[model samples]
Target: MSALTAPHLNRWLIRLHRPALFVWTVVLLGLGSALMCLWGPLADASAEAWQQHYACAPTGPCLYDQAAILRYKHIYDYATMAVLAVPFLVAAWTGAALIGRELEQRTAQLAWTQGLTPTRWLLSKLTLPAALVTAGTGLLVLLHHGMWWASEGRIGSAKSWYDPPTFYAGGPITVALALAGLFAGAFAGVLLRRSLAALGAAVVAVGALWAGVHQALPHLWTPVTGVSSLESDLPVGNGVDVSTGLLTADGERLPDPFCGSTINPQCERLYDRLGAVSWYHDYHPLSHYWPLQLTASAIVLAVAALLALAAFRVTAVRTRGLS
Candidate 1:
């Protein structure tokens, strides 16, 4: 039999996954609606409450609706969490439904026996899922960025651009991360060939990768170091601080001088004695955000490519009879 063309393979894959595809479509539509709602009415409410919070002045002694301000913060945090959780959900689904269940049920053998090479079978499995995952996650991140920016300068907004969730969920890095999760999950499924086990392990693997990225993120870009007077607050630029503290008179870095309070006489003496601190700090500035994010995304996508290669290699070798 002639080898099946890519279009035929894609059609077969879609037919096989019609149920899953339908569910995902419904889920995405619901999420998209929620995102639009957040951008409109939610944003309006949050902005109003935030303005009220800042309107209070010492001379005016005004009272603001604390509940409304708190509600805005809660909505922002939870919405961010929902977007950030996409990778984990993709990883679990990939490990279980995409590959593991196929292996566990031995249905993959039917495709191979039908003159479909193992390589083609595996490629078909990964390609459609990868495209759908990348597109879905990309859309979510784009929506997240819109919502994040809407509340950014608002007084009561609790989200920080440099926070781990916000940083990864609000940029192109998010698409790269979702791809990584898919590849990692596919690898686990092929290796373990047990649906439940692969699902659990795939999630764990993705979580570990996420943690590693967060820890190494600051170092991904070279940091700027600077010094200032002891009296000045730590310089917070567009970027987040990797490390920051006061320096002694002799250029030695000191632990933060928790001198109790600025009003305390002792606190004043110690701060003054610290004597013109070269307030040293290492940080990625706002300008560094994209560079660092893109660098990290490239690394993650490279790793995902490697994982894909490995999956193809293993699938072909183990089912060499079909090859």
Candidate 2:
């Protein structure tokens, strides 16, 4: 049999998945356009509305372009959600269409029999899709970041940089998550060999992975501690809160009594009884954003590599007899 080169295999893979390609392209273009609109016109309109709102008299009825502000907020929310959903979409498509369907239809087997090794077939299936997913996801993420940055401090309702959804959608971490979802779906497809089952498993796997990352993110970096006297309000600031509690005279951290400030006579008495001297906040500042994002992304990419390795191993085992 004549050798099936990489270009030939890639052409066949693209032909087989043309519909999926069209859908992905449409999604990218539509979302990118929305984000660009948000970054420029939508943000500017919302900012002007907020300026008008601030100009209104304190004690009199005033009118502002509420619709423009609400529209900007709604569009930003919807766009952020769409950016975050890319991973799940990639997971489902990779498992069901890219890998699982091919295996289920015996197309993979045919390729393996036609002078194409199972490993080469699997690589061909993944390579183009990974490249496309990365580029598309990265573009969306960059646009989301630009939109958020443009609205920052201008629109009153804009989500903060530290907001979880905004943070995920506006960084390279989303790109990592997309790639991880790709490998996870590929792993599920190779393991299950059924399109529907693989699709569910892949989505669930990505969900679980994201949950794990969310839970562990704050602890991934050492947090800055803010301390304040009991006479002051809580030491919490505009940052990601990891922990907030009371500190003893000896600096021992203790659970917060949830009482009001020491100016409140009743709360002061309670704090005296509890031997609480001050409030302490352990949190990540905005300065830590890049470090946290890079750290989390590295962890996700490592997991993706493992998943890819497992997919290849499973494929080898399944096709060993044919070889």
Candidate 3:
């Protein structure tokens, strides 16, 4: 029994999960390489194509490298989506293979007979994987951000910094999300002790976390208000829109009522009836990008910590009962 130690458990853990490690390595390398291409050559090619497209005369034959533009867009979309999917992948794999299988097959019980405490065992399960997930996910996000920055203003059709998928994939938020998924999966596995059931539950848990964050993101920070004349198109604010409506003379905000601009005779009549003088917009600007990202990431990390604590408690209760 003394021969078995934490190091031995960790080594055995890695050995038992070589296949997962290999697959994750492949995913990391593939995404990193693809994003690097986007950051350099692909973005350049697309930007050049757009330049040529704009340079063409209205009455002249146009022959820009449309293929290059499409290729960059396609690859960027795929890579961004893949990065966003990492959290779900982590949750599914961790729940199904890392903890659930051992518990279901009674192998985890056998390991406890050897000198490892349940707490130490759980730590061994989480520590190394958390490190790997953090490093890989962090690298991908950094690369994605670099690629996004390189394309800004250069690629006409490039996704905006606030685009939902781009924003999540290109920021620290995804790293926090991935970590949350890991702990969520562990908690589910310990609670369920069934691989498939845990897998589904873990995915659902992560999805719920993501949805909650998405809904709460705009409200996370104070938004700047933009007011414009009712005759102009809606207030010229272009970030995450919190709200848009008509503002009255007394500075009261009213719902837009889907009224068109004053160019429309009916819209002018409706505005007069409602006492609306101008359009008001509440939104986050580009300057608020880091604030939003950091706030959201911190919230997710806090949730991850809670999930981890819950997992440990569950493990403690179950192991104590067995003992």
- What are the per-residue Cα lDDT tens digits for candidate 1 across 194-223? 889889988898788888887888888889
Top candidate when judged by lDDT against the true structure: 3
* Between candidates 1 and 3, the lDDT winner: 3
TM-score of each: 0.87, 0.97, 0.98
Model 1 spans > 4 angstroms off: 1-6, 56-71, 232-238, 248-276
Residue range with the least summed lDDT across 10 consecutive positions in model 1: 229-238
Backbone clash count, each prediction separately: 1, 0, 0
Ten residues in a row with the worst lDDT in model 2?
232-241
Write candidate 3's Cα lDDT for 1-323 as tens digits: 46468889889988999999999999999999999999999999999999999999999699999999999999999999999999999999989999888899988888888877787788999999999999999999999999999999999999998899999999999999999999999999999999999999999999999999999999999999999998886776999999999999999999988867899999999999999999999999999999999999999999999999999999999889544
Ranking by lDDT: 3, 2, 1
Score residue 241 of candidate 3 by CA lDDT: 90
lDDT at 234, model 3: 70
Provide the overall lDDT of each model, using Cα atoms, as 2-decimal numbers: 0.78, 0.92, 0.94
Q: Stretches of candidate 3 above 4 Å error?
A: 1-3, 321-323
Give candidate 1's error at residue 317 in angstroms: 1.8
lDDT of 1 at 57: 82
The clash number for model 3 is 0
